[model samples]
Target: MLRWLRQLFNTSPLEFDESWRPELVSGFQHWSLLSQAELDRMEMLVTRFMATIDWEAANGFELTEQIKVLIAAQASMLLLGLDLDGYDDVTSVIVHPANVRLRGNRPSGGGTFSSAPIVISGQAHYQGPVLLSWAAARRGARFPEHGHNVVYHEFAHRLDMLDGVTDGTPPLEDAAAMARWTAVCTAAYDEVRAQGSPVLRPYAGTNPAEFFAVATEVFFNQPHELCEHEPALYGELRSFYGQDPAARISRPRRHHQHG
Candidate 1:
């Protein structure tokens, strides 16, 4: 009916260019970690993301296809296992050449707020466009060791806001799952604030939303460290993300000589 008609008139399905695979592999470290099948699926998702969203460049920055592909790849990684539509509220992606300085109010002590400018790498607004710094996004994609991915961090926020709430919790399966998620996340969040955690960085202690975002970066980037240090938290992330990055990542074994 109408669906069929729309499909008939719509353009052909978007496909990732084979030539771009090399660039993607060289730029994104996590790209090499994915299997062939996962790469295929990722390519499709990236294509859909690129086609659906309106890409914009800020401050006289030119929006290149490579940039679009790289950003879309990272953002699509978050939705690999989820079933919801890809950022339905996000209509545009605004990319800046470098870090953006935003004018806002900051606490100046003595229970006073003062006007100031804050430099940020990325930001995701509810029911609005996502803002990103191209330099930070590219660097984060290349170096997973940093555990600071602007694309993952902002897209994670978008996922958290899917249910009209900015809380750390996203849509869960059932009451039991929700209960477990809340318990594990609450305990971990408290621990992050109280004494700090080795696996999770200090930024996670900022808030529940930030905790989810920062945890996601570690979950995907530093999976081995996260699994070793925070097994429970890692388990929850694995259950929710439906992916075991630690298993996907290939590590060499050291042979010990007999004493």
Candidate 2:
């Protein structure tokens, strides 16, 4: 009864404008892969996401509706199969026009930390905002073959931090699932660190948290490659995300000729 009342009283999702669909489709390459039904759901999710989050622009960059929609669409894709609030901890999204350089402490050979300026494309803060480079995000959306998506990578980190832990594992069904996730992720992570994986990038080997984020980028962008190289890891992600991108992607057919 209370749940029903809450549903009735809660603010409805913003009405998504169909006119914007063309712009979104042109901006994001993956949009063509989604079915009509999936596109409808994504529109709703993106509307909700854009309405819920606070947006800001840095480095004198202009924040436009198109930028917000594109980012929201990519971020919402992660939550499509899950039954949770859309990035509850992500209160703000700070976007830069391009790569931002920041001074950070780096570990030296010894136990000392050195301060240096590091360039970053995107960053997800625990219990804070998501920082992104607009250029990188746009490029990533257009080119999935590159196996890099700033929006997916940073949002994946936010998902990893949902359980108050950033150890690469998100909230799961039970202990058994957690164990399996840990085992498979650990093995793949080790492979990336030791001999480099064909599917995952070298940056994924930085840490367990990064592994999860980078793996997510590859999972969504290059599903066929991920499934082929890291079947166990792909299975874990598929089970968790409840989406089969591999099946959705249609491969090109070769023509046979007879003389």
Candidate 3:
């Protein structure tokens, strides 16, 4: 069905074209999470974002361009530093107006000090499928002077799983980089759990998975603060992502906030 839709879209002349795409990708109303370069990367990630998503008009939900920008921005931000190579692993994203219902009696990490089981709000499986709620996605993108990005949170799982395990470690640039990332992230995560104040967000301490996602949010939306407060983590991230977003956020914006 997706291939059919792609062929049909390619055959159509009335849909969005690539020439004017970069101009429309922004989340000015609720997101200050992307740089012009980052946004352009998003344009590259999803100029055909709509093309890849299983676009549909569902009842009780209004999927707006703003929403598309929000999701694409978050997803693109994930790969702003490294080459986003494994995205074809998940060819479709299923979105609902709100959290979708996981199947009944689904257990979460059963037994061995993890037997508290129940359905989760959002899940990205190892089989290359992503699921999200429109409301969850919107709330996540609001950047409410807090940290928590649902899109990045779930998609981080996807990227981490590409190596055949969801252990919260994505493929790094080199072995040396991987060793350094683990060491630095572990130290930072432990520090945050021990004495670091909750400046970035609390979920960063939930686990390595949450740490990557939360780090991503702060890396983009609150770069200056992250840089100032968690210099080691910031430096490690600078090395990891290859993009200094804190530097980008510090520069002047050529465009004014129209709203």
Best by TM-score: 2
The C-alpha stretches of model 3 lying farther than 4 A from their native spots are 1-39, 55-66, 100-121, 251-259
* Candidate 2 TM-score to native: 0.90
> Candidate 1: lDDT of 64?
93
- Per-residue lDDT tens digits for candidate 2, residues 1-70, read 1335334423664688776687788999888888888777787788777767879899789999889888
TM-score of 1: 0.89
- For 206-242, candidate 3 gives per-residue lDDT tens digits of 7777677677666655666677778877887777678
Mark the 10 consecutive residues where model 1 has the least summed lDDT. 250-259
TM-score of each: 0.89, 0.90, 0.73
The sequence of per-residue lDDT tens digits that candidate 1 reaches over residues 28-75 is: 888888888888888887877776777899999999989998998999
Estimate the lDDT of model 3: 0.63
Q: Which regions of candidate 1 deviate over 4 angstroms? A: 1-12, 106-114, 252-259
